[model samples]
Target: MIIDVLKNIARFLILSLLQVLVISHVPLGSHFVLLPYVLFILMLPFETPKIIVLFASFVLGLTMDAFYDTGGMHAAACVLMGFSRTHILKLISPREGYDNVMKPTVQYMGKTWFSTYALILIFIHHFVFFYLEVFGFSEFFSTLLRALGSTLATFVFIYIVQFLFYRNDKISI
Candidate 1:
């Protein structure tokens, strides 16, 4: 129990710092925003309580907001992602269902599943984020273009990071 807590804490700090300090600095043009910090929220254990997931996501987003001064844009998006996570998991759950200890990492679920999952969440997050940032639909196509651009970039970045960094969960079968 304690170990899991510590690991999550480490993940939060490391990812948050990397997001604020490093990833945020890598400008992918004006339209593309790299959002690798979200991987931390998306990779939480499948069995994690909903409240904890929502709370953690809020904290993570708020931390990024603190760095970027985007008010609660990230926090709102994080909470939206957290709210949608369980539904997405249910939609993609295996035929045998999930193990109590299962995590929604590419290392555990494979490329296709994780790709779909991540892309959907990223698109939703980016859509809300960009739209909310503008708070209007006057520049609909332009906002959408920016959101899509950032979504694709963030998704690719998260996918690569998962492959290179996250450990493959051992299957006991």
Candidate 2:
């Protein structure tokens, strides 16, 4: 239990730092890089309450908003993603169902399911986030382009990062 708590805290800090790094445009075009905040949400113990997930997402978003000065756009997007998380899990749940030890990863959930799940959530997150940031419909094509491009960039970055650093043992939920 202590180890699990420590792990959770460490994950929060790492993700928060990643959020700042991505938003700060560290790699120039990296602002388009998908911050791996969603990974944190995905890593929570599978039995975590829905309300807690949403609340955590909102707080994470609000923290980002405070840093980025984008009002609550990030917060809103995070909450929406949190709200949709369970449904996505249900949709992709395996025939055997998610054992208590399962985690979201290429190895556990399989590449196709994991990719689809990540892609769908990432798209949803970027769409709501970029659009809300713009707060206007006039730049429809531009916003769509930004959303699609950014999603692709972020997705690739996240997948590569996870593949490199994600531990096989840690993957067991």
- By TM-score, the best candidate is 1
The TM-score measured for candidate 2 stands at: 0.88
Write candidate 1's Cα lDDT for 47-141 as tens digits: 88989999998998899889989999989998898888878988988999999766787777878999989998888888898888898999999
lDDT tens string, model 2, 71-124? 999999989988898899888788878776776766666679878988888888
Q: What ranges in model 2 sit over 4 Å off?
A: 27-33, 170-173
Candidate 2 has its poorest 10 consecutive residues by lDDT at: 22-31
How accurate locally, in lDDT, is each candidate? 0.87, 0.78
Q: How displaced is residue 32 in candidate 2, in Å?
A: 3.5
Q: Runs in model 1 with CA error above 4 Å?
A: 167-173
Candidate 1 shows a clash count of 0
For candidate 1, give the lDDT: 0.87
TM-score, one value per model: 0.94, 0.88
